[model samples]
Target: MAAVGSPAIVEASFISRLVTRKTVMIGLLILVVVAVLAILAPWIAPYSPSRLSVVNRLKPPGGTYWFGTDEFGRDVFSRTIYAGRLSLLVGASVVAFAAVFGVTLGLVAGFFRRLDTPIARIIDAMMAFPDILLAIALVAALGPSLVTVIVALGIVYTPRLARIVRASTLVIRELPYVEAARALGVPTWRIMSRHVLRNLLSPILVQGTFIFAYAMLAEAGLSFLGLGVSPEIPTWGTMIAAGRQYIGQADWMTLFPGIAIILSVLSLQMVGDGFRDLLDPRLRKDL
Candidate 1:
């Protein structure tokens, strides 16, 4: 009998495969850069994001202040980098939370066809309202805070991720090896978790990247609308909203934060695409 591979082995294989693709390598590079920046923000940032300087308010980008000062005279460059930490937190937390619920439900629903219809219907119903709208509603109902935003985004994105995992599981469960294992009376849990879920790692990883990126953007939207992290905390969305008041007077206030959002999203998208190219065989052929 063929040995079932361990989860660590499967994950390592996926990582090795992901690294083999040049595009994915570039994506990894971008992610590393962003991660490093976020991690090092406190030490690297020239000034406290919240530190005020009324005399230097709205100063343009120049020496001593790369991205200039905001209307409150807070260092824009420092704020941007510092905001990245919270943005990264929102993205990582939302996706991790969503994956736990989504993947488990998807595996169960897919393997047990009897449960698929009801679960799928529920997911469909949730998805019927756009993800952003759902998140907004959830946040509004729950009230603004880090925990609420993370949970709201997780719920909003779970259906799509569940669908993706379910589709992959459906195909995998029907394969001959799965049938053989079933015939041999192997534990259903073992087959599902060890064999089935392992095979779906690539899609899960790629999907995770997109989810992470979208989560950050969504959190930003919530913050912009004053429904996210506290205004006292410096975040990209709050910065943009703050900058809007002074946009006519100092375009840099708004422009820099906008650029930060764009770059973060773009980097995540590129990484996701690169993962797709490496992981999905059909897409690999196209590449």
Candidate 2:
């Protein structure tokens, strides 16, 4: 048998394990389609997301407009596609930034007993409020914009990631291999970077997907409340906000955008679930 630690073994195991998960495969397909549509929105979108037309306002699904037009006569289909780009950007950016920053803090806090007390307290304080409320306040205070939204979401999510990583690090730091590395005179930084951090990939990945999904949802909530990106920019939240007034008269406007948010969030959650199941020790045993 190949060495359990070998790269080849790991690669084979990953593929074999991944193939058996139907939910993950379906989620990947949906996510890829959404991503590709977002990337190609500029060329494929029939009209500008924000282009207004007096003649086309509230136009229901029919000729000239696929999904129909919003109250402003903007193309719903075009706006939906473009919104995916920003929505996804926010989700990916928040998780990517927070994970890197939070993991570093987690590693430090976990490895050093003195720092843990202070860091944990701050994390606890931040986490006391609901994440959405905290994010709303942050955006309101920071002023609305894409950068602010990303930063706000990152700050809101960092505590959770920090807690997860810190717990994992605490466990890893006590393991026999870690003790051996310490006794053999390995530097703390070297041992952490090379040995301890590697074992953390599965949990980090699982947590990251959840964070990404929540960030996207939080951005939508903020935008719906008028605290997101500029009102001029096309976003699912903005579309829903605009459509909410005319929901009885024109349900398509709100319905399509709402569906977009649901599908995007659901896709991420499904993928996250797949990752969680794949990473579980019991599941690994079956594999």
Candidate 3:
């Protein structure tokens, strides 16, 4: 038999391949720009998102205000920039929470076959509820707050992520290397964490990107419905909601914020697709 490659070598090769993809580079650029905007919102924004100037109310984009002012005379450009921070935070936090919790549960369930059926059934029950409806219900019951929104979104996403991780874990668990680890007197947790989890990383990362995109949209939906972060907080969803009344006369009020949400979501999805293809060796070969 040919000698097996070291894990570090395999990982390095994978990273090299991922870097070579044009789509990956573009995706990275988009993500980096958004991240920078989020990080520097306070410094980059010309005015406070919540600051009101009656004289500037509903002003269209011009030399005075780059993205114009909203109904309350708050700078739309400022709000949009700050809102980017909230949107990115919600997306990243929700995905991170869901992925970590979901993957852990999946690892436990998949490694211990005795727990699989019941755990799978529970996940199925959660999945039976429509994702948005479930999120709404959770938020409603928990009350409308930023933490509640994050928890609701995280809970709503966990089941789907768990299913994905479970399937991946199941496959990885059956791999000969996992069996070898077990045969060598490795503890169950060690085998699962060290061997199986590492093997499942690619799929988990791909799933996480999609989850981040979905979380952003979900947060917007909740905020639009007045169930998300407090109105005092400037978010893209709340900005759009507040501007809807001026859709006809002050189109800039809603248009720019809406476009930002759309573009962010689209970029995330595109990046996710690119990562999916890049991380899967079979898919990479097909490309």
TM-score of each: 0.92, 0.96, 0.94
> lDDT per prediction?
0.89, 0.91, 0.87
Q: What are the runs in model 1 whose C-alpha is more than 4 Å off?
A: 1-22
Q: Which candidate ranks first by lDDT, i.e. highest? A: 2
Q: What order do you get sorting by lDDT, best first?
A: 2, 1, 3
- Model 3 sits at a Cα RMSD from the real structure of 2.4
Residue pairs whose backbone atoms clash in candidate 2: none
Name the 10 consecutive residues with the lowest summed lDDT in model 3.
Answer: 1-10
Which lDDT tens digits does candidate 3 get at residues 46-136? 9988899998899999998999998889999889979999999899889989988999889878888999999999999999998889999
Runs in model 2 with CA error above 4 Å?
A: 1-5, 285-287
The candidate, 1 or 2, that scores higher on lDDT is: 2
Query: How many residue pairs clash (N, CA or C atoms closer than 3 angstroms) in each of the candidate models, in the order given?
Result: 0, 0, 0
What is the Cα-based lDDT of residue 221 in candidate 2? 91
Q: Model 1 misses residue 209 by how many Å?
A: 0.5
